[model samples]
Target chain A: ARPRVGYFYSGKKPGQDISETMNNMKVGDFQSIPVVVREDVSVYDAISQMFLDDVGTLFVVDKKSFLTGVLSRKDLLRTSLGNQDLSTIPVHIIMTRMPNVTFCFKNEPLIQAAHRLINQQIDALPVVIEQPEGLKVIGRLTKTNITRAFLSLSESHEL
Target chain B: ARPRVGYFYSGKKPGQDISETMNNMKVGDFQSIPVVVREDVSVYDAISQMFLDDVGTLFVVDKKSFLTGVLSRKDLLRTSLGNQDLSTIPVHIIMTRMPNVTFCFKNEPLIQAAHRLINQQIDALPVVIEQPEGLKVIGRLTKTNITRAFLSLSESHEL
Candidate 1:
């Protein structure tokens, strides 16, 4: 008889029990540095920051550090080429606004995270902690992080 | 003056050219590994193989090594828990069929690859190459690989 995937009865199970499991999981386990910009920043500055940061996506936040929108490389390029004055405009003008942006919780399971990435069709999702009024952006969950976790999990089981 | 988000070239550039620009930019880069299993193997056996190999997903192939379906951990678990007789059943019954699976070409840019992951909501995609008459599965691209690429790209840009 071959070995089976042991039931994770102790720690976490996918679906309905995620919230409880999330509380148990450490935030550092899957955290990734987020690329962020201020709302008042110029589009050129945002683009330059993205290039400097080497990230395809950038999170737009207000002075309070609250997430307001997202500026992707594609979004920047399209907006920049569409306008006549590249240096005079602000990133918030062309950014994809809140409520439209998809995000995930910081303590989410890798499996659930994978599902979010697939279902949303976005490369990266901001990892946030829920507040009474809204969400607080903390880290990021990317397709790469999920893949690495999967690989590591698989390898550990093998060993 | 604030940097502008738009207005780089305030003229009507052809949509095709923008599409080309999007295609040219590399989104993520990483290597993929290929693993195959026969249909006659028990789900238990297959799971063990997956565990031993440190892969979350496995490609179910036929005697000719042609791609058939995919068996992921979640798929296996969902199927097994639903029926107690999974130990006797072959893996092919619950595996996702090839037509339903999304894949990528070797030369396709990372951006396109990332899009596939986002749209498909799958953690891993089998990388294939065009053959004379059909497509051949070469490697797999996963979220982990993409994340690694993103981080490295960021590091390189900083240097």
Candidate 2:
């Protein structure tokens, strides 16, 4: 006689479809803190920062702290094989400069970013905020984040 | 009186559960070809092989072709910083030796493998088959593969 009010509470989002749930996943929700280095930093120092921070990619910023390039471990490894003095060579010399850098926006769907990572054959993407001067890297979205999102799918459904 | 069989064919699995679908994804279905190197190969050669193959991780095998260790881009980058002769150092010295390496099996569920990738904080895992002699490296599972699987979920449901 109470209109079956209590029976509807199943502790789950009623009729929540998987596709709808996935589409709601945003890059800002899963992105990690981005690591950035000044373009003038040495390759040796950049490598050191990579190890110290334990990240796979580093965004290169200009004197105004605007994104100018990106650096990956693969880039650093390739340069190491050159037998050049790493300490003397600036990261800008080896970095993948703008106009070639692949990036994403935080408010976008995570799936879109995932496609970019796969198609571009890259490890990470700088999540950027468009600015009057240039792109400002706000976060890092990578395969690791995608993997975590994949795991979360199962985890949420398990409940 | 065919019980409306034709109408029921909506091209979707009947009453399919999200968790059930996820658990059905196997590691073998998403694994990539493993790039391996001999334990005796010089660090320089290993690095070269990694670049040629464009893989982030390399499995190290013994003379018997049994899994012995694993090498990551991080490992090689650290070694490069030593300023030592990379060609003179065998990968065995820098590799993350067996018993310390985290691996997976092809038959394992993708969700389980994804958990390992997140918990271990490793880029990739050597998918292996256990033999009487030792583990045989059969494939490689990485974050890239996991990311692909994530994309597939949204794709399959889009219809």
Candidate 3:
């Protein structure tokens, strides 16, 4: 098929304008599978889960499987510096608890989520669904995801 | 100044094409200050430095100040899980050493460096200056920087 290029309006254009294309990019299109752990799980186990999943951030959930908190590698590392026993300490004691966790919705524009990442200085955000009980994590969005989106933008328009 | 838009090329346009603008974003324009630790520094001290600097990755250098290795919080956290004393273990023993390290030059297109970060599955890369002896650590390129660039693109064109 010939590359989609429009004269002025869409008379059957192949590609959207750059701004239009970028603005249309949504978090759901690029989010990754979220790895979650229950609030009572040991910090030691949480760290293990992090490595196994190879994610920088992990979402913490309650017994109802609703969002409760968030854990980062930095958080775990800081706790490790203490002389406390990691296995005996539950992640809830160390996690950045709910009402403090930054989040995004799957339908949110990628640019808005990217701004949250930069301004908040965070590694990842749980892409969540609003539940009667609490937020249910449906996906993970990170700088990595934004970076991928940025690359895709350039790739799509490349000759 | 009115927003520059051209019908084709040259003439009296103000804004260049999206592809041209994206391609022109160089690593040097977006890289962050690199934080380095001597290879011989204790893992304990390195972790402290990471918290102090608030950076995800730390570059390792030799006495001569050339890049030798790189450390991520994951590396340090893994070491912490060990029974051994962190202060006794040197960062050199745990760092991802040279030759295996992925890097980018200052003049490299941001897209190229973003690819290296994703392909290598790393949080950051040392923006380096090559020398006869080894690579000189100059700046740090990370997903965060890429995310910022992505946001900037949207902000620049927003009405």
lDDT of 3 by residue, B1-159 (tens): 243343432222133346666888999999999999999999999999999999999999999999999999999999988857888999999999988999999999999999999988999999999989989999999999999888878777654
Indicate the TM-score of model 3.
0.91
Candidates by TM-score, descending order: 3, 2, 1
The positional error of residue B67 in candidate 3, measured at the CA in angstroms, is: 0.5
Structural RMSD, model 3: 5.5
* lDDT of candidate 2 over A25-75, digit per residue (tens): 999999999999999999999999999999999999999989999999999
Question: What C-alpha lDDT do the candidate models reach, one value each?
Answer: 0.62, 0.90, 0.88
TM-scores of all predicted structures: 0.46, 0.91, 0.91
What are the per-residue Cα lDDT tens digits for candidate 1 across B2-104? 4223323322211122222234434324655777788788777777776677666788877767777887655654443342455587998889987887877
| Models sorted by lDDT, best on top | 2, 3, 1
Model with the higher lDDT, candidate 1 or 3: 3
In model 3, where do residues sit more than 4 Å from their true spots? A1-16, B1-15
In the range B98-144, model 2's lDDT, one tens digit per residue, is: 89999999999999999999999999999999999899999999999
Ranked candidates, highest DockQ first:
3, 2, 1
**Model 3: share of true interface contacts reproduced:** 0.38
Instruction: Pick the lDDT winner.
Output: 2
**For candidate 3, lDDT tens digit of each residue in A1-159?**
343343332222133356667789999999999999999999899999998998889999998899999999999999999868889999999999989999999999998888888888999999999988799999999899999999998888765
In model 2, what lDDT does residue B122 have?
97
Choose the strongest candidate by DockQ.
Answer: 3
